[model samples]
Target: MAKGSNCSRWVLCSLVKLVFNDAYISTKIHHRQVSPLRRPPTAAIAGRARVPGFGTRVNRVCVRAVISEGDKKKTMVETSKELNESAVESGGWVDVRAVITIRKKMKENLNEKIEDQWEYVVNGMGQGICLQLISDQIDPVTKSGKSIESYVRGWMPKPLSHPHIVAYMANFKVPHDFGCPGAILITNFHGKEFYLTEIVVHGFKEGPIFFPANSWIHSRKDNPESRIIFKNKAYIPSQTPPGIKDLRREDLLSIRGNGKGERKMHDRIYDYAPYNDLGNPDKGEDLARPVLSGEEMPYPRRCRTGRPPTKSEPFSESRIEKPHPVYVPRDETFEEIKQNTFSAGRLKALLHNLIPSIASALSSSDISFKCFSEIDKLYNDGVVLKDEEQNIIDNQFLGNLMRRVLTAGQQLLKYEIPAIIKSDRFVWLRDNEFARQTLAGGQPKQELHLHRMSVEEAIENKRLFILDYHDMLLPFMERMNSLPGRKAYASRTVFVCTRTDYPYAADGLLIWSAIKELVESYVEHFYPEPGLVTSDLELQAWWNEVKNKGHYDKRNEPWWPKLDTKEDLCGILTTMIWIASGQHAAINFGQYPFGGYVPNRPTLMRKLIPHEDEPEYEKFIHNPQRFFLSSLPTQLQATKVMAVQDTLSTHSPDEEYLGQVHHLQSHCNSDHQVQIMFKKFSSKLEEIEKTINARNKDIRLRNRSGAGIPPYELLLPLSGPGVTGRGIPNSVSI
Candidate 1:
């Protein structure tokens, strides 16, 4: 199996199990249970004792332990370094392991599981074995009382003692364990340190699988993380995010660990996750994006800011005392929020438009050019005209022809750049910026038809959709957004003509369907009935937390769906998934590819179209392209944005794609239902890839496979490392 495939296999216990069966380990130092928060004392604690046993008294040792769970049938072991002469002065070996007791009813299949596991350890790892045994005279995991026994039993070919094992520690302690047993295989039979290059988990519906160990258990010094699988079986340390999910359309940057010292791991989450859950604030705030403050000092060139296209501009939300996810710049730093603001900051949409797949490509606020390269080429061909000396001429402009094919607007004059650029000969479609922006991809309008089609007829035919961002943002444009080097408009939005919209929507549906199916199956398995959905306390808690914290400003909006039925829950999950994966992928990966060409998707329109009588127009008649380039983002902003885009768009080697979400370390033998459904989801994604491949080949899809058009495969599920302009990760892992 490839490294990015399956995650470690132990399944996490649910809320019920968390509440009732959690396991914890503590020993008295000053004759009291050690505080989980207090760091272990180090100055006088560098020694070990030769004694080995648990249940009688605290015997201090210098070596650390790599612990795992033990049962009659199945067992896993983990080992550490040999006794530290320097630190092995004296200390008790804490039996921080869960010893599970199986009932007679569950014993029928217990032997089979044991046999399989025994074969797994013996055949895969080989002989000369050592095993420990202990009855629950005193429960070792939770010290309701004292002295719990510690032991492991596995098969080995020869009889030999595995000695001198050492255990490493991290900064903090591990979290609680639900009823699930701890797990791992450890041996000191060999002298060299055994690094976990891979971890194979069994019992998933897809059978046994090996995943990259670095993703979870990083024993290497570079990214040292070696937490026991049972450490956070019930919960890991996590924090509720402060409304950063909306950044980059949804940046759920969080952690998924509680391992101390070398066992520390940095994991990400989706929504409101358990302290150990990588989905929410529990640990996400640690990775929350810092707001970019001030601005990059414009480069050597004379940087210019256009007049407020609208009188009002917003530096923040309209009615808030401070933005909900208020971004305060750190120090006087001049760095972009590259991690959280993928698409927008790519071209620095905060200064221009182009909110990625989130804002419709049609909206003045969102630039949808990656999939519209052909149209941009046509816009360049027919509209950009020049004389023998390269001066732009108004009469020579292909006005009528442009009107026939593109969304052309009234001509304007006087926007200029004193640099080499002479005039505003590049006439931007400012006439109906609203129409140009929103008509193509609104929510309900569905209006991307031929120019000849009547608006009423188009609407009647269901060719239009509008998300109504114009009114929502208009009020703040004049007040909060008017920073220097910015172009703010009241009625900016996204529009898409089903035909011209290219693959964002069409191909995105492929990903959406697979995600929806997986979410639905998961919901069915967990909820089972509407009543179950309504009664689910944790589920509702998560939903309420998302709204109150994620969209705190708009939590009162009437559109918030009540979680009364499973269908409602499914819809919510699907929408969030689409935003994070498919939609984000569409707007993202294409950053440098589309935004690299400044003329096509201008970052900021510094100069407006000059009127024929204006002096700028006279300059426009002299040199056109330079004037056009000057109207966009200044060279400084453009180059900086490009650099930022390159970094953001490139997928790292450890990327986890949409259907390939593993790395979730399990602490117990897994349940097969959800894993089976996830496996099917992955299969469906493969099917989607084939369909997209076929679509790109068929000449029937003109926008997709037409001449001069790059085959629209940005939505294809797989991609190699780096910025190949594809791959939909499971979440916005900012």
Candidate 2:
């Protein structure tokens, strides 16, 4: 037989035997006398003697002793019961029988209380290798009963025998009702510590607790799977002291052991944990136990965060001696590119060029664009320009459109971000909380609902910026566009003001303020430019000067749908969406060729700072935004390599407010806006399909219908390549 086949056979046999051992133990317990269980101490004093079977069988023997004691009581209780019955028949009260019965009942209650204190450790970790302290034990220091906190503090890890072996301790708190064993699980392991002698607990009233020599086992540091497999069997310290016969911890090639020799192993209820839990050792304990705070420990970043840096952004700070150049040759000459991409004059001439996709998307907000297209078609075919009857008919059409749009707006405002993003998923699970809440009165409405601030408290508590963008801004823009088109447009010069919900609900002034803030933030992060708007007064003054200069009129002139009234705040929203959604999407596709959210943009603010309340927060779950910002600079560099430097540097921070609007209008018309949007959307779907196909090359997962890439991994940027019709040639600079 092949070596691999033999290995597989061995593993299968071991698994079978382990399963059988668990079943046998469970069945044996039922026949054996039940009694109180005593849990072991978390640690023993360092450098203590390793007595064979002492640490291993102490708890087991304690239960046996309790059972023996219970049997003695049961025998006395039976004799007392007979005496009590005779006394009752003779009509005489027997105090001896009553007292013995009471004592027996009291003894049973004591054993039950002890049993509760030491529950079996049930976890998904292949087997429970450790005992759990379910209840408070006598504090070694104070001599009074105390919680796990006090006990954990008293037992400190001993210094490693070797200089290279670095040891650290971690505590796992099992959550209540999670089917976990209640305990403060501690594992003292070392890195590069092949010859770790033993781990001893410090401070105790009784003698020190000692583990087996070479018990400080460390798995392969590089292998993630090895670290994940729990240390299931904590072998008992052999009666004989450490010598040539004993194997070193490093001798065990695998975490589950090599299954080599017929080693004597003890299997208990806690040993064969059914749940296969990770991180937590106990299910029925409080999970949110505060991380034990102490002097800053020299732990590695990956261990703490649980997220290693990607290839583009390595965690180490080692600087390259000769950095790779970002610039690459492109087809277009620098001067040619300068005119087409940089000057911003030509691009700014057409509004459709700037925001075709956005304008097309907004069409769904109203029926006027479609109706007007038909209306214009009829007029062109040979209708008179000015007809009273035609005007009245148009007014009626406008009124009905307004009524429906308003109703749709009302319906759109109450939907949450999750409901919007995963609406299909919600509908499928009819019993989902969001679905139940939304479809309460009738069948679900198809119109997109805007999220109400009152109902957004749950998302607010998470404090994620992307979630806020989804829950508030996206829906608001959809609803706002649904308003009556022309009259709403005519109500221009509405006093502009700043509001928290800028770009979505706030007037032009607020949206402009938001745009300014975004530029200022970019400048702050990248250019180190001072004197960017630092105060509200400065921003307002800047806005006033720009508005008075007729810059707005110049920017809006290129818009093709010249309906004469200037209420179109599309400039502000278009810019906002470009910054919020478009840039990240483009960057992600440039890197991973995927169509999901990109994280780690170097230019964006990081949201993964330690939470104020959780001083010792362990980030096992990485903040998506952190990755989004960290990777942004690399995306910009990639864009530079693609010869798109003009996109980065053309719009000076000073000109951003007016420049974006002017540039967008320069290249687009109303009809082209709808066409451009369709092209872009179609392109995005194609990219998504390509991404799916690329990953599904694995034959094992290909045939499974629902086995596409995981939703989290499928995360793509909101934008992609070819989004803009204009060729953004490649460069290699940032």
Which tens-of-lDDT digit does each residue in 45-156 have in candidate 2? Answer: 2222232221232222111000112243343345334433433211221111111000001123665535322311111111212222221233345342222211111121
TM-scores of all predicted structures: 0.49, 0.16
State model 2's lDDT. Answer: 0.23
- Which ranges of candidate 2 are over 4 A from the true structure? 1-128, 134-183, 188-501, 504-734
Instruction: Name the lDDT value of residue 715 in candidate 1.
Output: 90
Regions of candidate 1 where Cα sits further than 4 Å from its true position: 1-452, 465-502, 661-669
lDDT tens digits by residue: candidate 1, 300-408 = 1100111112112222112212323221111111112223334333433232221122123223442323232322342243222223212212234764553343233
lDDT of each: 0.37, 0.23
Task: For candidate 2, give the lDDT of residue 715.
Answer: 21
Residue 230 displacement in candidate 2 (angstroms): 19
Worst 10 residues of 2 by lDDT: 96-105
Instruction: Provide the lDDT at 57 for model 2.
Output: 29
